[model samples]
Target: MRSLAPQREETAMHDHRTLGRELDLFDTDPLIGSGLPYWLPDGATVRHTLEEYVRDVERRAGYHHVYSPVLGKRELYEISGHWTHYSDDMFPPMDVGSDQVVLRPSLCPHHALIFRARPRSHRDLPLRIAELGGMYRSELSGVLGGLTRVRSIHLNDAHVFCTPDQVADEATAALDLIRRAHTAMGITPVRHRLSLPAPGGKYVDDPDLWRRSTALLTEVLDRSGLPYETAEGEAAFYGPKIDVQIADRAGRQTTLSTVQVDLHQPQRFDLHHIGPDGARHRPVMIHRSIIGSVERAVAHLIEQHGGAFPAWLAPTQIAVLPVTPDQHDHARALVRRCADLGLRAHLSDARRGTLGARIRQARLVPYQAVLGAREVGDDHLALRLRDGRRLDPAPADQVLAHVKDLVGAHRTDLW
Candidate 1:
C-alpha cells in the first residue's frame, strides 16, 4: 500500500470480475489452463483499443514496432542471464527435438538481438524498438486472480538503444510518453519509485555499472522535477528502473509502467555502434512500458469506471433501440449511419421489451438512441446517457457531430 489518493468511505458495490461477467468482457475456464483467460467480444474490443492507443503513442515517439515469436531458444536466455537469475519465474523449456525453447517471459532479450542484427552508426543511436509482445510466466495457481494476475500477458514493451551521452534524454522522452499515455486514459501516477539493487544481492554483480546507471537515472528524474523514492534491493537483476505507481479509485496503488536503464545487456549481447571518432562503442539500453499489460490495465479501468468506459474506448459507444417492430428499419438505418460516421454503434431491438427495460439494459452502452415514431419520422435521435440524462431530439448530422467531438476529445462525459 504505497501512498495513494484518498479512497471513498463508501465501498465499491461491484468488483471488476463481476462487472466483466455481466458485460460479457472476459472469463476464465478450468478447461483452458488455470491462469489463462478468454477475452470475450467486449473484452477484445477494449484490448484492441488499448493496443491501438499504445502503438500510436510509441509511433509518435519514434519507436519501430516489430513482431517476434513468443517462444525463444533456451540459449538465448542463457546469454541474457534470465537462465541464471529469472528461470524460476519462467515456464519449463519445451523439447523441440534437438532444440529446447521456452515461452519468453519478457521482450528485452529479443529486442537486444534485433538491435544487434545489423550494423549501426552513432547516427543510429537512440533506436527505439517496440512491440505488443505476448509473454508467459509460471505463477502458482493460488496467487492467480482475474485479469490482474494471469499466466499469459500482452505487454506494451519497448527498448531504446542509445549512446551513453543520450541516456538521460532518452529516459526523459520515455517518461513523457508514459505521462501522456496515462493522461489520455485519465490515470494518474501517484508517485515514482527508483528501484535500485541491494548490496551483495542477486542483481548483476558489477558495482561500477550499477553506480553509473543509478546516478544517471537520478540525474534524469531530478532534471524532470518528478519527486521519487529510492527503494533498496528492488532493482531488476539487469539494472535500475523507475516504477510508476497508479492508484485506482479504491486507493490501491499498482506499478503499471516502468522505465529501466540497463548497461549490461549490450555487453552481454555484444551490441555496438560506430561512434563519431569511428570507434565501435557499446550502447546503453532503456527498457520501458507505457501500459504494462492489456489485462491489468483494463481490469483497473473496469473497476475504476465501474464498466462505464469513456465514449471513445467503450465497446459499444451508442445503442440504437426502436419503439416497435415497424421502427426496426429506422433503427437499422441509424446504426448504419453511426457506423459510417466511425462510431461503435449496435441496434438493441425493441421487440425485447418496453422502452424502460431497453434503456435499463442499454446502461452498459455509453449512449442510447431511442427511435420512436417522432424520432424516426423527424430523422432525429433521442439520446439517453448512462448517467440517466436524456437529451432533446437532434437531427442526424447534429448527433453525429456531437459524437465525433466526444470521440476526438476522448471525453468521458456525455455531451
Candidate 2:
C-alpha cells in the first residue's frame, strides 16, 4: 500500500505556500471562507495556460467540449446515487421555492443528462464529452491548506459513451492520454492500481456488473502490458477504475489521474443508443480525468520546480532591464517586440529598483535581457539568464528568435 504522508525534506525555502505568498500567486481571505482561495493575476495566468493546453489535447483526441452549471437539482444527484453515497461530502442545498438545489460535487452526473438529451445511434458509439468546470465540496476547515486541498475545484473531466465492443479500445486510448499528459508535465508514475470492489456495501449492488467490469479493466491493462496492483474496495460506488499515482520531487505520491469503467450510471439515467439491429441498447460510460484538478496540479508543479516554471508556462517569460534611465526607451521597445512575438515580457525600469536589484528580482522570471549604453548603441542585447549565466552581446534578431524557439518548444531552460 502507498502511504499518504509526505516525505521529510529540507523544503522550507521552496514550500509552495511561501513561494505563493512571495510571488503573489494566490491568497485566502478569512472573511470569504477558510477553504476558498482567490487566484491573483499571476496564478490565474498559469492556470489559464494549463487549461488551454489540456483543451487542445482533448480536442485532438476527438472530444466534444461542453459547459454545465455548477448548481444542479436535487433529483439529479438522487438518480446518480450521489445523494445517498456522497451526502456527507456535499454542500447543503438551498431551498429554491418548492425545489432544492445544491452545488455540484462532480461533473459526471451533469454530463450524463446531456447524453440523455437526444437519441444516439451506433454511428455515435464513442461520444466523448469534456469540460473544465468548477465543483464545490464541503471540506473540513482543519484540513484545508494551500491550493492542494480546497473547497472549490476546477477539473478537466470527460465522459465517454461507447458500445460494449468498443470498451477495450477506448480504455487503452484514455490511458495513453494520461501517460502523454504526465510525461509532458515532467511527472513520473510510481505506482498503478486496478481498483475493485470489496465485501462492503459501499459499491453499487450488482455482483454481475462488478465482475464484468473488473474483468474488462484487468484484461485491458494486461493487454496494454502495463503492470498494476489490484486494490480491493478502492473502486467507486459505480465502477472499477485505473489510478496512476505520481511522485513529486520530494517523493510524495498523489493520485491525480483516473480512468473508470462505469456500468451503473447509464442504466440509472436510462441512457441508450440504437444498435445496427435497430433496437435500443444501453451504453457503457467511461469517466476519465487526465490532470484531475487545476489547483492540485499547480500546487504539485510549484513544489516540483520550486516556483521556476517552464518557459512555455511561465507567467512572465522575460524581464527587460535598462542599465540606467537613459536607456528606458530601448527597454520598452524590446518589451513590446517580445510581446508581439507571443511572449510574456515586462520592463524592469529604474523606478522599481537599481539595475542590480532588478536583476535579482528577475530570478522570479525565466530570462533576463540587460540593455546598456554599449548594447543600445550597437543595437544588440546583453542577456543574463536566471541561473546567472551571462551571454555575450548578440544581435537583436538572433536573441528574439532563440527566445521564441524555447517558448515554442516548451524548453525548461533558456539554453
Candidate 3:
C-alpha cells in the first residue's frame, strides 16, 4: 500500500508536472477534459521507444504479445467479478443493440478468454500473454491533475497461466524483469510490499481462497531475499500481490510494478489445462506488470531523470551543432551518419545563435556533437555529454559508433 502524501513542495524541483510542461512532453486541454493528456512529438518518441523496448524484453522472455479490444461486453466483467466488486470505479455500461458494453478497466478478463480460447496441455504451462493496451478508469475530477493519475491508461499488463507448481518460479522471474527494467530506465523503487486483502473490503467472499493466496505470496516473498513490509488491505480484489513501490517528487509512494497470485479469476472463468495424468486441472493465474501504466511510468521517469532521459529513451539522442556556418557541411555529414545509425540526431540551425547558445539549448540531450573549424579540419568531433563531461576529440565515425553502442545496450555511461 502506498501512503499518499498530500502534494507538497518539498523537493518540488523535480515535479513531473512542472518538468513535463518545461520539456513539452505532454499537456492537458479543457476540450479533451481532465485526466487525459496528449503526448507531443517528443513525448511520443519517448513513449514509442519505451513500448518497443518492453516488447523486445518480453519477446526474449517467452511472452506472447497480444492486442485485445478496449471495450468488452458487460457480461464479461460480470463473470470476472468486476461488475459486482469494482463498478464504483468503472464507467456506466452503455446500451448498444440490446447488449450492454463498457470500456474495460482491466485486461485480465480478456487474457483469460484468450487462454480459454484453446485447450492446453501441461507443456504449455506458464503461458505468458502480454499487452501494452489502453483501459479506462472513472477517476474523480478532484484527484485528476497530471499524467500520474489519468482516465485513459495504457498498461504494461501480462498474465501467466501456469500450474500451481510453477507459480513460484514465474512470479520470481517477473520480479527480476521489473528490476532490470527499472535499472535501465534509471528508476529506483522505494521498497517491496506484500499486499494483503482488507478485512472488511469488497473482496470475493472466499476466506479460504484469500488465506491460501496470502500464504503463497508470503512464501514467494520470503524466498526473494529482499526485506518488505506486509501492507494490510492493499491487495487487489481477486488476489494478493507483491508491489514495487516508487516515490514521487513530494516523497509520496505509489505502486509502479506488481506481481499477483490469483486463483479466483481462474475459478470464475473456469480456466484449466490438461495434465500428464490425462485430467483437466485448474491453472493458476499470475498477473504481473513491469511498469504498471505507461502514463504513470513516464510521469515517474520525467521526475526521476528531471527530463534528462538516458540515451536510449531520450527524444534526441545526439544534437549536432556546427560552431559556424563554415562548418555546416561537416556538421551535416555527422548528422546524416548519426541518422544512418538510427539515432534521433538533430542539426542545429545557425540562426539559433552562437555555439555556446546552441550547446546550452541542447543541454538535456544525452550527447552533443559540437563541430568546430579545428575539429572539421581534423575530421573529428568534439563530444559533450549532458552530465557536464566532455570527451577528447575523436573521429566522427568513432564517436557515432560509440553512441550507437550505448543506445543499443541501454547504457547511461558516457564513455
- Could you say which candidate leads in TM-score? 3
The clash count for each model shown is 0, 0, 0
lDDT of 1 at 291: 88
Candidate 1, poorest ten consecutive residues by summed lDDT? 3-12
Give a tens-digit lDDT track for model 1, residues 1-415.
7443334332244466677888899998888988899999988998898799789878887999999889999999999989888898999999999999999999999999999999999998789999998999999999898888889999999999998889899999989988887776767778999999887777888889999999989988998999999999888999999999877656777789999999989999999999999999999999999988888889888887778888878999999888888899988888888888888898887778888898888887888888888988899887888888889888978988889888867666678
Q: Which pairs clash (backbone N, Cα, C closer than 3 Å) in model 3?
A: none
Q: Which portions of model 3 miss their true places by more than 4 Å? A: 1-10
Candidate 2: regions farther than 4 A off? 1-9, 248-250
Model 3 agreement with the true structure over 142-173: per-residue lDDT tens digits: 99878999999999999999988888899999
* Backbone steric clashes in candidate 1, count: 0
What TM-score, over all chains together, does every model reach?
0.94, 0.93, 0.96
Candidate 2 achieves a global lDDT of: 0.87
lDDT of 1 at 79: 94
Q: Looking at model 3, which ten-residue stretch has the lowest summed lDDT?
A: 2-11
- When 1 and 3 are scored with TM-score, the better candidate is 3
